[model samples]
Target: MEEDSMDYTVFLEAKQLRKQAEDDAKLLSNRLALLRMEEQKALKKIEETRRKAQEIMEARIRNQELLKEKEEKERLKQEEERLKLLEIQNTKAQDRMQREQRVEGCKAKNRYEAKELKEKMQENLEIAERKKQEELEIKTNMKNQIKTQKSLAQEKRRLMNEAKKAQAREELERRIREQEQIRRNYEDSVSRMEQEELELIQRLQNTQLMQQSVYEDLEEAMRS
Candidate 1:
């Protein structure tokens, strides 16, 4: 009965050890899965961030060109207004009725000049707008090129991370296999120990039985 109880205890211990190893394996698997998921999420965020940055840079360049063109147009308009005012003031300074005729010619000349100025202003505004549009387009194209380069860099980084993760996963698998082999080795040792203990107990019981039989035979011989 003692031998049977001892074997049962050894079996229970072995079972518990196996359970512990299995739990550890499961935990490692879960950790690996979580890490892989986090890595993927990081890669996706990097891509998105890069794309947004590119778009913002393009917008900024276009805005700058448009602003410069608008300022140029406003400057030309102000200059035209100043010229018109100066011409009007000059005619106002003339006084006599005979001078009125000469002033009238000057007035017609001023009107013609004002008309030319208006046309010139219009032409300048159109030119400025066209130049601004062209500049904006060029800037946008340059921004796109920059963005493409940056995106490629980000992709490279992401791929590197993925490669590292794969390496880690393989390493983890190897470690797990090593651990499993160790567990099996430990289990084999435990089994061998239990067998040895059982054999020792059986040998001790057999020795005790032989001594008891010898004493009984000696007692019978004395009675005879």
Candidate 2:
């Protein structure tokens, strides 16, 4: 009975130790599996973060390109506006030059008109003086004619009052002498008056011709 009991006790102790070792090995295997699962989860999270970061960087690059394009368009528009304004300024300068030239032309025309008017006034004054001189000459000629006629009549009356009819031939000769003297004086006076009147008439014709010529010249000049 003692040997059998000792053998059985040893066997029971060995079985209990083997069972404990097997339980410890199973616990180690479970911990290793849990660590592997946690490592996989961490790697998945890191990949997701990297993908989101790449997306953000790409979006920023596209926004930068759009902003650059918009800035370029705005710069071009501003340059166009500046060029348009420069053209307008040049046009205004040209207009001002034309206006100045027109004003200068008007001033020259006014000066010419003033000179022409002054010349016409001088011509009119000369014509008035010539007319007054002609009137004075006519009055002088009429007075001379009246005096000659009065002297002839008084000589004839004196001859009749003497009653010297002895020689009819002498009386007739004396009468003829008186008549010839009066006729010669009257003819000389008429010749002088006729010459002066012809000269006056010629002057008037020349003045009329000059005026007509001036008017024709003015018409041709205006047409030109």
Candidate 3:
């Protein structure tokens, strides 16, 4: 009886241990299932976070490209403005140079005209002095002849008249030739002065036309 009871107790203990092991196995399985579900949720969260990060990165890159493009446009605009300002400065400088050249040319021409007028006045004075000397010599010769005595003077006068008439005719002819030469020289001087004035007018007109052309070109460029 004691041996049978001992065997029965041992069997019962074995059965209880088996039941406890089975319960522990089931609890472990439930924990493993719950851990798997949590792992899947973590994976989904990681994927969402990675997607959001990729989107953020793409947006940052796009923004950088836009910023660089804006900067480039701003730089190009500034460069164009600088070139325009430089061109304007160059044009103004050229205009000033042309104006100075015109002023200098006019001053030189005025000086030349004044010099020519002075020389013409000197020539006229010389011509008048020469004519006055010729008249004085004729008056002195007539006075000396009148002082000679009556009978001797009459015989001398008849001989003198014949020679005097021939000399008078020659003098008149020479005087006429000199008068014609003086008239020709006066006419030529007048014609030359007229031509020089015409040339000066033409040059002024040409300069004005050139200035107009430059202004028109500048206007066109500004419009463009």
Q: What is the C-alpha RMSD of each candidate to the true structure, in Å?
A: 38.3, 73.0, 61.4
* After superposition, candidate 1 runs with Cα above 4 Å error: 1-166, 210-224
Off by over 4 Å in 3: 1-5, 58-224
Error of model 3, residue 36, in angstroms? 3.9
Evaluate model 2: give its TM-score.
0.21
Better of 1 and 3 by lDDT: 1
Which candidate tops lDDT? 1
Q: lDDT at 101 for candidate 2?
A: 97
Q: Is candidate 2 or candidate 3 better by TM-score?
A: 3
The RMSD (Cα, Å) of candidate 1 is 38.3
lDDT of each: 0.69, 0.68, 0.68
The CA-based lDDT of model 2 is what? 0.68
Give stretches of model 2 more than 4 Å off. 1-8, 55-224
Q: Output the lDDT of residue 126, model 3.
A: 99
